[model samples]
Target chain A: MSSDAATDIMDGTHSALRTHGYAELTMQDIADEAGLSKAALHYHFDCKHDLLLAFLDRLLARFRERISDVGGDDAADRLLSLVETVLLPPTDGEPHEFRTALLEIEAQAPYDEAYRSRLERFDEVLTEEVRSILEDGVAEGTFCDDVDPAEAASFVVTYVRGARTENVAVGTALGDSLEAFRGYVERALLAPAATSVTDGGDADDGAGDEVDGE
Target chain B: MSSDAATDIMDGTHSALRTHGYAELTMQDIADEAGLSKAALHYHFDCKHDLLLAFLDRLLARFRERISDVGGDDAADRLLSLVETVLLPPTDGEPHEFRTALLEIEAQAPYDEAYRSRLERFDEVLTEEVRSILEDGVAEGTFCDDVDPAEAASFVVTYVRGARTENVAVGTALGDSLEAFRGYVERALLAPAATSVTDGGDADDGAGDEVDGE
Candidate 1:
């Protein structure tokens, strides 16, 4: 099958999963949603599990691309941008479909080892990205020397994941909570000199120079 | 049905939900798990939804009781204990079955209005308890006067819920993250005088008197 055809089939599977959930999903439903014959859908994916795996791969790739595109020269800015990308609802104001779908998929993980392993891999990649940022920040003397990069990265990932999960249920913006997290990062993670230079009363003056260097 | 019999039924339902998840759960499975005839199970709860609702009610009650029983004289200690009770895995190292079940139920919330409403009620009750603690702390000058109890309480509840959800998938104890949260509370929420008096090098002397007051 062409890649475009596979994409269309996966998109249909996503819609079906969202509407009917994993347990109730069926091949007929996916085919109807995709506006394709059952044989055409089967040509791309032999079964529901295969289609879901493909969909997950696509989602993870998109996530990696988005994180990479979160552009900023300053390490702190880049970290903050990554946090926003991971946690915030999209600009279109729809309930976060990807996250919602991921939760459903995760529910099946206990029974499906493949799903569980894929999720673990996704988590490791996320934790590594955050750890890399923390390591860079510490090496550059931008973050505190005492901060354990691994633990702090785990903390950030866990907290952001938690916030995203709660937001789905409560329908509330986590903006205030994110602000609180940022404040914690500034106070507890940033080196004193960096904190003073970046967030002090004269931040505008110092920030301009930093931006120019970027 | 006797209250004891009802409790047994709910317990069995909990086990079934944990093992098979909400989508796959059936009344027959719960009946078998409970060692009761199908008719007897039906006598307690007419349908799966009714049984789940009852189970959630029991869970909420137990949560309230646990929070109330968290013995601490100081507001900060009480708050910390409350956080531990809600977020930590059990001492016996069992996976958090109730929270795992909750995640599954929450996934069904979009399609189940009854579950959505019950979860909202649970969230409100939890938020209120946290808010009440913050208010008490502020009145006692233990927490910062500038802290918005409502927003801060919401943040705490949201973060804890998120942590619980993620822990279900990742199999990590939320211990380190909880420590981070406590650190945030001490630094950002406590009044300076209270923080120093409670956590400073001279805390042993000051805390003795506070403990005596209790």
Candidate 2:
């Protein structure tokens, strides 16, 4: 089979997996869905796991490409752009189904080693990108001086992940949720004085107080 | 069964649920693990769903009880207290198993209606608590004049949830992670001007500049 033809078959199989979930997906189902011979499917991928890993690999590559396209004046803007890109819904003709598939794979990765490895690598790339942005912010005095870029980046990524999970929870379109999340992220990353309640304002002192009796 | 005895069995089942995931767990396993007969288990919980709901209900009660313990201050202190309480590991012997079980149930809630209801209610309570805190802060002027306690509280809860998920991911002892998360939360909650940067001098703009880049 031609390489281009094999790539198309792989894409078709990934689409099927997204719609049918991992457990219900089968080689025959993918081949039939792709209108390819079962043997031909095997020619490209040994099994479902290989195909899933490939799908994730493609996702990471796409993310890297988008990151490359995202340019900004400083770390904060760059970080925001990076987040906005992921959180925003794709415009016309963008490969959204792949994202949905990758999300499913990420949710299920904990139970699968190969999938988990792929996800860890994906996470590493994301963290690295975020870390670079944060490092820039600190150097440029755009963010807090003491902010640990890696730790802050980890929290930021986790926050986005949580927001995405929330979006998934309410069944909100990923695109719309991404917009709301951008607002939250903007506040979260803002320089401290811009939004903090400190400076002897009616600040809650850093001590344990009661929950509701006040 | 005596009310106390029934409660004991329920707690036991909930405890077992935490240590074992919902999908991988069984009533028989809970019973065996709890050292109780299947009859005793059924007498307390009609089925798994009922049992799961009970566990959630108990968690809610515990949360309310904890919240109610905060007093002797305005909303800011109370709000901080609530966060502190959440940050502190459950020292009341709630059992590490309970935390694990709660995480499992929380993870599954997105896919289950009853669990979802419980989860929504959980969020509602947290949001309300935050609103109250913000209201108090506004009245007392401890928080910023422009601060919206309700929104701040929402961000706080989301941050906590995100932190909890990360703590679980790292698989370290809960106490240490909780402390680290508490530090993060404290910093995030404070007015930005308060957190000292590594250098003695503050950044050029105490307030962050907004970049027009998207």
Candidate 3:
């Protein structure tokens, strides 16, 4: 089978997994859900784990595209862009449910080394993107110099994951959650120097809202 | 069974559950682990879910006790105390694994409504505590007036849960992982006023190393 065929099947399985969960997902189920024969399902992917990993691959590909969307000339703009993307509508299709199913799978990942590694790799890529943005921001004076790039990167990614987890668990869209979360991002991400150096200038500056883009 | 006898059996079952996860645990496993017969296990609990709920109840009771330890104090102290308690070692024969196991159960709780309600209530109570503390601080001129106690409170609890999830997935102690987490909490829970006014004056100054106390 062609790669496109394999991708299509993986996408279908990802969607089904999100809606039905891992426990309920089976080879036969994916075959039926994807409109393919059981033998054809086996022809492309070796097993369910392989198919799940493919879904994660797709998720990473899409997120990387968003990371590349940080077209702003400054670090603050880039960081804000990343946050805005996270706060925007979750990608339409199986990807959203794929995330939910992934969270469920994450619960079992401790017992499964392969799943854990996949998650760790995904986190590493995200952290690198965030760290790069922060590093550039520091160089440009757009971000506080004293900020720990590594920790800030982790914080941004972790906060996004937490926000996404809450959304998926509760079925709320990111737009609905943007205002409440903007306050959180302000405290968690903005430079303290930027806030305090100007004598309450930061309070009314609306810097947070501008980046949040709501 | 007599009340005292039932209590003893319940306690034994609870301990056993803590040591083994829900999926790996069976009535026979519980009975054997708890030094009871299959018949005795059935006499006390109808099914695994019943036993699981009882175990969750005991765990919730312990968290309540922990929450009470830092209560009625100043908002910062209360919140910081709660963070320390969560990050510190367990004081009363409570193994860290037990809490990890409880979190593991929380991951599964989404599939079951009754369990999900219990988990939601758990989050609601802690979030409320944080909100009340933030409100008090805002009134007392400690936290900024613009602080949204509800949202801030949610961030605190969610941040802690996310941290705990990391620890469990990595099989690391909270202490081992805490160095990385310090920055995240600072951003998530610290008020802007507190951060700007403090100026690293006392970052860890009086934040005692004692995590849990007898």
Candidate 4:
């Protein structure tokens, strides 16, 4: 099949998934969304599982494209933008519903090798992008010298992933989470005071005075 | 049913879940593990869903008990213990398999009100403990004065949740993540130098000097 044709099928899959989610989706729904016959879809993909895997790959490609074009003033801005791109929901469908469907798909990773691999690719690519930006930030003096790019990138990506799940599972506001993350980046990441990690290995002195609950 | 009997049933559910996972689990498995007939199991819970919900409730209770007992020298240590309690997988059955089943169940939160409620309780309790610890740390001067306990608690909980998901989905090393988190807490939360947040919202000046990628 032509590349454009395949893209169309992938878009169709996205629409169908948004509507029916993973549990109830079918090949027919994908075909109907693509405006192709079921036989036509079969001609391209053997089964729903195969089609879903390909869809994930295409989604990753789209993500890569988006990242390359996400212009920003500094590496810090770019890193945040890269995170927002994945953390926030797309406007195409009900945010909660789409996340629900995505979570359902993600839950299959441990049991599904294809799904696991695709999801890992997504994580790997995002982590790399964040790590690169972090390195840039450190070099430009926008971030602290001691910042470990790869480690921080992993943390950010993992936090973003969990935030999405929180948005769906517990209705935590994504905007609040994003703002919280931004604040963290500002205080903890951007220009942190050079400090050592010496805790003295000593317990607290029980100065427990002036302790008021927030 | 008696409290001890119910506890036994919950224990059975846990074992059954670990052995068979959420997808393949059945009432029969739970009953067998509990050393009761399926009919006896049904006498307490009408169906598998109800029993599973009860199981989640019991898990949270167990977590609370564990948290209460996890004594630490100071609030910071307490906070770390609190986070670690949930971040690390239980030493039961196969860790990956158990996490997979748990992820599958968490994915059902959107469509399953009972699951969502139970899971929310988990988040609420963890966040509360973290916030309480942050407050104590601040009062004791172990943490920064400007640290917003609630906001930071939310971030920490979200990161921990994501870290657990990463552990299951991508096989991320939980130990490495915990160490990284410790680093973050030390640098960001623990007595950070009193500073202002004045970035001026200005774009990059492009000094473009001494730029070395990490």
lDDT of 3 at B33: 70
Tell me the tens digit of each residue's lDDT in model 3 across B91-123.
755565555556556656657776776776667
Order of models, best lDDT first: 4, 1, 3, 2
| Maximum-DockQ candidate | 4
Q: What is the interface RMSD of each candidate, in Å?
A: 2.4, 4.2, 3.2, 1.0
lDDT of 4 by residue, B1-214 (tens): 9997797898898888778878789999999999989999999999999899878877888788776665555566667777767666345433677777788788778788888888899899988888989998788766788899999999998998788788777778887778778767766786633111122122144221111111
- For residues B84-203, could you state the per-residue lDDT of candidate 2 as single tens digits? 677554465444455445555554554567887887777778768777876765566444455556656665666556555444433334354344444443344434432222222342
Arranged by DockQ with the best first, the candidates are 4, 1, 3, 2
Query: Model 3 captures what fraction of native contacts?
Result: 0.25
**TM (chain A), candidate 1:** 0.84
**Of the pair 1 and 2, which is ahead by TM-score?**
1
Per-residue lDDT over A1-214 for candidate 2, one digit per residue giving the tens place of the 0 to 100 score: 6877767776677668655644457888788767888898898889988876776687678777777667665565567678777677345323444344444554444456687676667667877888888887677755667677877777666666655544443333555444444444344454443322112232134221111112
Collision pairs in model 4: none
Q: The CA-based lDDT of model 3 is what?
A: 0.64
Which is the leading candidate under TM-score?
Answer: 4
Of the native A-B interface contacts, what share survives in model 2?
0.10
Two-chain DockQ for model 3: 0.37
CAPRI category for model 3: acceptable
